[model samples]
Target: MKTFLLFCWLPLTAQAACPTLLNQQLPGLMGGTVDLCQYADRPVLVVNTASHCGYTPQFTKLEALYKRYRDRGFVIVGVPSNDFHQELERNSDIGKFCLANYGVSFPMATKAHVVGPDAIPLYRQLITVSGDAPRWNFHKYLIAPGGTTVTSYGTRTEPDDPKLIGQIEDYLNGMPAPAPSVPPPAPPRLKAISGS
Candidate 1:
């Protein structure tokens, strides 16, 4: 009876360990779905990206970061977004660009909405929990192991930023995440124009 009870409880524990924010399967960049839950136990950097954006060059640095820390339980997920009118229309083109130009091996999601009400379920929850949204392509959200905590970095925060690296290392080493950085200013809301 004790063995039976232990077996029943183990699955529940595993399920509960995965963060709700990470319990999503995004359309994979190449094909199929990229299961976020698979990275729940590691420190994963989720960045909203665009193939033609000015910050696109950051992908090179990002790939470097992934190569450096991936062996230590770190992952980086690129979420291509066209909300800013910069991403390629086809996932295949996007994937090819990433591979040919930057050699990005980390997981990447197909084009997604990273802003406003149309944002994907994962991005929506990330916005609500962190009170920050991708203001532009390359905006990043650093989620600690198990999503126990999250920190936001704006588009300009380079992948090699010391503070960003420090936070990642902290998570990998089981250290507490650093305090939230000063968030970017909220975007201006458009007033409804009443017409006669």
Candidate 2:
């Protein structure tokens, strides 16, 4: 009985360890559930990409970045999106285009709506945390280890941008990644004293 109970609790512990943003299993381009939680504790770069977009060439740079940093616990997950109408109609086609054109080997997700009401849970959480949704294809979000923070980059921000690469390096090195400034805590409200 104790062994059976331990087995049941182990699964719960594993699920709890998944970041809220990546708690679900998203469908992969290759026809299997990509259990995102498995990548927990690793810095992940999530890009909303399209096959036919002009920025499609960015895949080459993304693959380069992935290959350069993957051994250091960094991974890139491409989320093929059609919200901008720039993606191929079929997931298989997108997969082929990425592999053939850029030799992309990073994990790719099925075509997903990455903005507004139809956005997937992962994308929604990304927006909620970063306050930046994909304005167009190739928008990128770099999620630091522990998934407590995310940095947003516009579609035009190339994968090799110094600022982006610097932050990724910092995260992988266990240093704090460059972050947006947060306002200091508001001054304590003073209580009014009434003298009768």
Candidate 3:
């Protein structure tokens, strides 16, 4: 009985190391699944994206941002969403467009809803804790290491915005704000294109 109990407890203890919010495996944009726990203890930026939205071009800046900081325990996970009616119809196309147009080499998840009751579990937790749903494509959420803190950025926020970079640096340097639950005010956003 002691041996059986010890074996059962071992897996539970290992699972406790990763936060529940990041314990999921999102389907990869290219293929297979992206085990979110692989990024545990690292600063992760999650973005809701679209292939045809005005903010689509932000992919360029996002890619550059990822390349600049990825070596220092930073990662960006692009999530193609159609909630705003702008994403391509298929995952393969999304993979190709991002690579061919923006040269995106960062991690990208397969298409997933980012708003409302049907949102993926990660987005659901993000919205619940951050109190801000994505208003349009390219909505960003910065998850601090250990997943204890999350900062929500609206569509207007640029990928290379200084404040966002500062926050990322804070996470990388292990110096997050005293209270970062609420993000700073967002800049004016462009009107979203409907039925694009």
Candidate 4:
């Protein structure tokens, strides 16, 4: 009876262990949408960012990480949020500032509220799966290649942290080669809109 019960619980336990943000389309702050399922074969790091925050300089490191590992099937997505304070003025302006000042080349979504009831749906889902919301600027979520939320790091964790880099390397080594014809879409563009 013990053996049978253990066998019956195995599937449930395994299911719980799997990370799940599959097939969800997160809106871009700029002009397109990214379907998380499309990048299931690559690990993704999502960060909640602020343009005028103290940690804004981390954008440079974040860009470097993306450039180094993007070909190895990894990506970093930035989500600008004004949750803590009115730090980010406008979504389009934030994009321009990042590119001009920090040389940021990764995808950045439009500015959105990441902490309150009006949080974007994708972030709402992210918070549910990861069990935490962005407390401040630069909170990072390292997702596994198979779309599982592997770990969540706070603002203090730099992009090049040894442990984080090791985890990314491990995920890269485990990923199978991507299909030949499925190139990633171009980086999202900033939407045309008035300032906030």
Candidate 5:
């Protein structure tokens, strides 16, 4: 029992060693701390969201994509922002609104600035490497598995757009397909020499 418990707890502890790009924590909209490291080695779609933006409706498709691919190691992270003055005033309000309006079940961060020098550290790093930043709410950054590749998308690209979906499919399919399960060689057939 103790060994089983230890094995179960190992992954949680291992999250502490995630790569730099994902080695941080943020307040989750669901009233908990979301350790970004836990998502390392998984493809993640990070979006800067706002409650009152014209593109707000994208949440539905975003949630849909999340539901469709999450079981396959895909994640969607929503970062509520007021940089464009479209976000709600409080995290609770933003969380409630998203749930009520779009049925969003993915993780979301507390409201923060996602543009300019005041942007969060992660966003700054994203901008530094991607050479593009959120020009408007709902702008997305798709981080490929292993947290190495990042692709930027403008707000005009809806979550369900074929182009975006294709990239996601490509990345996911690119992962070395799981090795087929091979049964252990049938325990060498028991041979009873039986002192013959």
Candidate 6:
């Protein structure tokens, strides 16, 4: 009985020690903390965004998808980046534009460097574990309910694209529903840009 109890406790103990997504908390434009761990048990769709990039329009689809599945235990997180020379001049300004233009109500993190040497620690871990990095704006990471990165999609993957949506639905409706309130930690802040 002792050994069985120890075995059961082992995995729980390890999870407590594991670095969770909520540890890196980032402030959202709405003045709230964006903690990935809050949505820990839910499937997350992470996207690197840019305001001026051609893919910027994807925000519309992204938001639509969020509304469609958010109640079903799926979330879409947007991380603004200037790595492609396409983001707004300021992090706050990026928020403003996203709100004014895209009507984006989903959570968004502060602007951060997503590539190169100064990339945020979260992105670094993402790259290391997935063997891929944000190649361009709109690159997506699909995280399973268990906090493991399940898959990655390229820039061409639209937010409502069938392939992507199907996977999310599968995970959301799978055996045990994912935890919906745990969010990951915030990524490191990047150099702030001046609003244009």
Q: Candidate 2 residues 55-154, lDDT tens each?
A: 9899999999999987777889999988988888999998898899999989999999899999999999999999988899999999988889999999
Candidate 4 on 1-196: residue-level lDDT in tens?
9999999998678555444665566777667976666676688998998888889888889999999998878999888888877455867788788888998888877787777799877677778888988888899988887775558889999999999999999999888875677778999998899797
- The lDDT of each candidate is 0.90, 0.90, 0.91, 0.81, 0.88, 0.83
The reply for model 1, stretches above 4 Å from the true place, is: 1-13, 175-196
Q: For model 6, what is the error of residue 107's alpha carbon versus the real structure, in angstroms, after optimal superposition?
A: 0.5
RMSD of each: 19.5, 17.7, 17.1, 13.8, 7.9, 13.7
Of the two candidates 5 and 6, the one with more favorable lDDT, higher being better, is 5
Expressed as tens digits, the lDDT of each residue in 77-189 for candidate 5 is 99999999988898999989999999999999899889988999889978887899999999999988878878999999999999889989888887766457788887778
Model 2 RMSD vs true structure: 17.7
Best by TM-score: 2
- Tell me the RMSD of model 5 versus the true structure: 7.9
Lowest summed lDDT window (length 10), candidate 6: 17-26
| Best of the two (3, 5) by lDDT | 3
Q: Which digits, one per residue and each the tens of the lDDT, describe model 1 over residues 1-196?
A: 9999999999789778779989878989999889888888889899998999899999999999999987777999999989999999999999999999999999999998988889999899888888998888998899988786889999999999999999998888894444467889999998999897
Comparing 3 and 4 on TM-score, the stronger one: 3
Per-candidate clash tally: 0, 0, 0, 2, 0, 21
Model 5 — which ten-residue stretch has the worst lDDT? 172-181
TM-score, candidate 5, is 0.82
- For 48-107, candidate 6 gives per-residue lDDT tens digits of 999999889999999999999888778888889989999887777998899999999889
Candidate 3 residues lying further than 4 Å off, grouped into runs, are 1-11, 175-196
User: RMSD in angstroms, candidate 4?
Assistant: 13.8
Q: Flag regions of model 2 displaced more than 4 Å.
A: 175-196
Candidate 3 lDDT over 98-149, as tens digits, reads 9999999989999999998889999999899899999999999999899888
Over the full model, what C-alpha lDDT does candidate 4 score relative to the true structure?
0.81
Q: Mind sharing the TM-score for model 4?
A: 0.77
- TM-score against native, each model: 0.82, 0.87, 0.83, 0.77, 0.82, 0.78
